[model samples]
Target: MDARFLGIPELVEVPDVAVVVDVMRAFTVAAWAFAQGAERIVLAGSPDEALALKARHPGAVALKDGAPAPGFDAVNSPGRLRSVDLGGRTVVQKTTAGTVGALAVKEASLVLCAGFVVAEATARLLRTRGCDGVTFVVTGEDGQADEDLACAQYIARRAAGTETDPAGYLHRAGASRAAAELTQGVRQGVHPDDVALCLELDRFPFALVAAVEEGLMVLRPHAVPSPIEGPSPIDGRPL
Candidate 1:
């Protein structure tokens, strides 16, 4: 169970048992929607596509999308979704990061949806499954900064049976200094709170495990191992 950090595109060659992450929004928002009792989530790569899916499944669900281009229900914002009610309905989400990364990893043996919000459950799933050659692909705007790196470091430490003082890795990864100027950093400008959210171990129990059906990324909540714990030296973060 060897683990090392690789840039997003660098993941292509590795055998992927990936837990795709986009904590700032995307995946994090999905976790929230699931927490609110959404039955399933479909990760659409673009806003237009998500709307189309919603149109096809109207009255039974809600659809949302966000893109720099106008006309989306809303941009990917967890804060925006916090007050919404999604009881018993599925959600279709389209974002630039989470869904795209999930789709790219469709080639992997096991692709589980992950975010800072559910870091604990994710790591628990990985340890329970005993994954080999795991890859964490960060889908930046064009693939850059990728807060998934924080979640990955958390998982990498656990997979190898080691401990990582995140402050230490943040220093090593130079995220500390970068944090100062991060109001304008990589992968479409991720904020400091994004880092905090992505690393909150065991905050939720949502994992979007899925595959590309036909051409769309379809997701289902993965079964998480029981009694998830906080960051641990033995089990680490998931996937």
Candidate 2:
């Protein structure tokens, strides 16, 4: 069966395998956490729940996000996650949309957390694994589709053995580049550096697959370092 497409917010009712994208940050940060050596990630549905989970996990890093607080660990920046020491530790995260969307898709046969940072490898995985009819859920902002739809369409095209076409994805119904642009525009207003960070393709060789049974997320690194993470970069030095 071929995979179908659905907007991220609509996933609350669907019953199919899902690929969750929050490319601007949430899933990107989650992938970064894994790259930074996090053992597992507990994606919370709300900020309050994340705080509660933090209290329960003791010593586990917690990120509570409620209406854009500046002091708290905002779970929206991949750059922030890069600096943290997640080595063998758990991270409890809440975000404006991504984490909640992941929870919504928890009932799927497989819920994969994805981002444009790992786009190519993720698409390759689907083809290699023969994933059919997977749904691309772009965890949109305020019921509007986010830039995640670009990532989703990129994956879908790859799965269908088609070439990359950003416009094709952006122009489709329920896949609004305008919504994505608005979200990215907001990010630009607050932190332009992050906008660039989120656009870099295939920086991490790993894919963070949602491990529902264990109530955690798992990272699977591709066999080779992504071109972005060239030998010089991984050779204990900058590339």
Candidate 3:
């Protein structure tokens, strides 16, 4: 399989498999939400659309970043979501980068939203499905999102059967300006533990696959088959 990396969503050219990454928080939050038992997530292009979607599906939970929307249940923070039980509920999520990037790839045969939390699972799924090529979309605009870029690279390496130590990538991501903003409490609605939560590499066992259903981009967790030798090691140690 061949791997190609692209920065920003606008440059994507409808590749066979597209892995849209947002490591600072968006996709990380989605992965944690799924781990917390969320049934599915509907990605909205904007906060207003998220509210509208929530209104249409009365039981759905709406989430966004920064300021709180009128009817949103919560903002996009995996730290805060850690305690919420979302078993069997639909999440309507609108984010600045992640969700937008995932929705932007309208023509890819497979669209998977990813972060370090689901990187390995995503690569495993790609191999299992026999995808000959993949394009990793760094959702951060203008190639400025170092965290997202690191995640895309890590996933690409994993897909190519490279045994990598994710520590270096994690270090690069941790030093990014976005990470500083989150750690310094500059971004509202973000908890102190949000950064740590976002950096937990390969925390989830499934990949978040996106598809349009009834005019909404829906993300569902698809479990990848486990290796016979059990979970792979990270930096020569068990994950």
Candidate 4:
């Protein structure tokens, strides 16, 4: 399998498989939510979309702009959700990077959201599926970020069956300016612990595989090979 990394949301020709990376918080939060028993996560590309989804499913947890939307359960903060009960619930997350990147590639055969939490599982799955061409989309707000880049690099290398040193990438991720700035975004109610959670590598063993149905992006938890149920349908509700 051949893999390439692309920045921003451009689709000159979307690849056969796209792995969207948003290590700062969005995808990472979704991973944790799934681990804590959330059934599925809907990746709404904008705040208004998330709000509209909430209007339909009033009990869904809505996260917008890295903060909890008013009347929502929690923001895009893994730490905040650490103690919250998410079993059998649907999460509507609208982020500046993660969801935007996932939504941009409308033509990809497969779309999976990633962070350090699901890096290894994602790589293994890609190899198992025998993906011919893979594009790692880094949804960096400023066009690039260490957290996103590191996660992409890890997956790209692992998919190619190459040895990877995660320590260096993890270090870069924790030391990136984005990590520092987001930690201080306490002004936006972002706690420092949330930044730490984003940097925790390989915290989970499953990836969030997505599918577009009726123009909406929906994600379901995916694991390696036999246990995997392929991707979610656009209109399929979370499990």
Candidate number achieving the greatest TM-score relative to the actual structure: 3
Report how far residue 3 has shifted in candidate 4, in Å. Answer: 1.7
Supply the TM-score for candidate 4: 0.88
- Could you tell me which residue pairs clash in candidate 1? 116-198, 120-202, 122-238, 123-237, 123-238, 158-236
Write down the TM-score for model 1.
Answer: 0.74
| Pairs of colliding residues, candidate 2 | 2-133, 3-133, 3-134
State model 2's lDDT.
Answer: 0.64
RMSD of 3: 4.8
Per-residue CA lDDT of model 2 for 26-139, tens digit only, reads: 777777877787767788776677777778776677764323554345455665567777777778877777777777777777677787777776776677567877877777
Best by lDDT: 3
Model 3 residue runs over 4 Å out of place are 9-12, 229-239
Candidate 3 lDDT over 94-212, as tens digits, reads 99888878887856789999999998989888887778888888887655689998888888888888899999999998998889999998888899998888899888888889988
Sliding window of 10 residues with minimal summed lDDT for model 3: 230-239
List the pairs of residues colliding in candidate 4.
213-234
lDDT of 1 at 230: 43
The deviation in Å at residue 121 for candidate 4 is 0.2
Alpha-carbon local distance difference test for all models: 0.61, 0.64, 0.85, 0.78
Which regions in candidate 2 have their CA more than 4 angstroms from the true location?
66-74, 165-191, 214-239
